[model samples]
Target: MSDDLTKAGCCAGTAREATDHPYEDRARGVPPADAVTQADLRTRLTEIPGGIFEMGTRKSTYPDDLDSPVRKVKLDPFLISPTTVTNAEYARFVEATGYRTVAEAEGWSVVFHLLLPDAAAHPHHPPGLPWWRRVEGAFWAAPEGPGSHWRDRADHPVTQVAWYDALAYCTWAGLRLPTEAEWERAARGGLARKKFPWGNRLEPEGRHAMNVWQGDFPRHNTADDGFVGTAPVDAYQSNGYGLYNTTGNVWEWVADRYGPRPAPGRLPERNPTGPCDGLQRIQRGGSFLCHVSYCDRYHVHSRTRNDPDSSTSNAGLRVAADL
Candidate 1:
């Protein structure tokens, strides 16, 4: 184990032995996380006066990407969280209801490669990238790997949560997950046809502005962005619209369902939800796992999807509401 893991209690069994459920045979799906109590939620609403913005990517950008089918969208004013949900905020939900996260309850959660130590020492682990481990006892509270708690990461985004879990939190908070369109609009930070929330340049200068993979990827992270794993919520500057960490840190769940076919070239100008139903839900804002060599979905218009019931160490949520 690495020194950080030791300090973070990665090898400790105190939290691990607390697991009452059996491992190996645990069902494959989101086991409930701490439930939301009536009081844990705080609501803030913003009315985005209706307007038209050029939706999707332009030809100059990564037009080949599915999410970049540039089109116009009209949206009604709505209120959304100024920042992604934090660990401190999520802790309130857990403390109030005694909710056990899927990873904690099941005894394992998938962790990224760079987050783990060398695989030869931890031989029972999966292969390929030793970083993506089914870490025993990993959860939102202990995001780095098993036994690592969220005490220092309280202000960081709450990860290792599923779409359903996000929905549950949204319900408790009297907010909802933003539709894919709404999410993209807010991520753009009111900048029309911009490649990123900040502007056309990925890094305005030689400086690293967002928390993304900086080195060889999977194997090495230079932490030039000042983050190895997740950064504090306010670690970086906010986008033009005052949204923090909107482009990186963790992938956020959106309310829209994934469509096998691209959305119609001509979409409703106003507040369009996604397809009626699909196998997966949309996820946006590429995670800390993103790198230029692999999984560069960090661009504002980029998107990916996964099973709604699935939860990974890199997944989290932000809340939105109707105006």
Candidate 2:
């Protein structure tokens, strides 16, 4: 196999036998038994054994991001998508249900600051950050502003999907969005407390192992990490559990509602879901827009939340099963 493929964990030569996780065996190339059938959709459900793990970072890890408070979390065995939902897969869902994504229905979505052409066009653009433009016609089909289409991003994670949209696709596939606990546990991939899925080292050998922004913050993206925008679904190495893009590419929506962590001492020790009624849902795995200078939420335990009705070009989802 080629070195790039091996580095990307796509070689699957001797590494397949040596590093393959048994959970991945359940749905290697087969769609879930009850998954919706579509010509272009491919589904892989991986089984994740649950256990206890630290759910947040130490103050020293990321001093500024106070949202991540270290806590112990436990999960139950569940099945999750081997990869993020791709544009092609989501297209299948839209074709079948005629579902209009939030971005499409809302008539606009948030694009990164660097993606816009003229920084001065939108006066309301985040104060100092003029790169994020509220471009009209910017939806899932057209991620890079109005005229941009999904042809080149067919294998890329389908962004601009709202919580409802993700839930719809999950239901159509006879699966469900993963609970926050399930999402984090699977992301950890059996590796206890570590900065990323692979380990504490962001780039073990000074090489970009995952798809993330490189170079200066919002002004410049060198694409040294192999892609300036979204990369292919399999563009990066899988975690210990054989799951791909768990930390980067796009933010994934989970099933649980958003709420403050239970006062550290009062948190649950077993399968804990978020609050009963909340306005926003949990989103995991930062997106391609993540940069060290701006947002470095690509870590395994890192998380963010958004209103259920909100959708952006950098948000997407993965499905999970109870069995």
Clashes of 2: 2
lDDT of each: 0.67, 0.68
The estimated TM-scores of all candidates read 0.81, 0.81
Candidate 1 lDDT over 48-116, as tens digits, reads: 456778776654233333665577888887766767889998887667556565556556656665576
Off by over 4 Å in 2: 1-43, 60-68, 116-128, 265-268
- What root-mean-square deviation over C-alphas does model 2 reach? 11.9
Q: Compared with the true structure, what per-residue lDDT tens digits does model 2 show for residues 87-159?
A: 9987876676666665565566656656666546643333344455556677778875666788878999887
Candidate 2 lDDT score relative to the true structure? 0.68
State the lDDT at 309 in candidate 1.
52
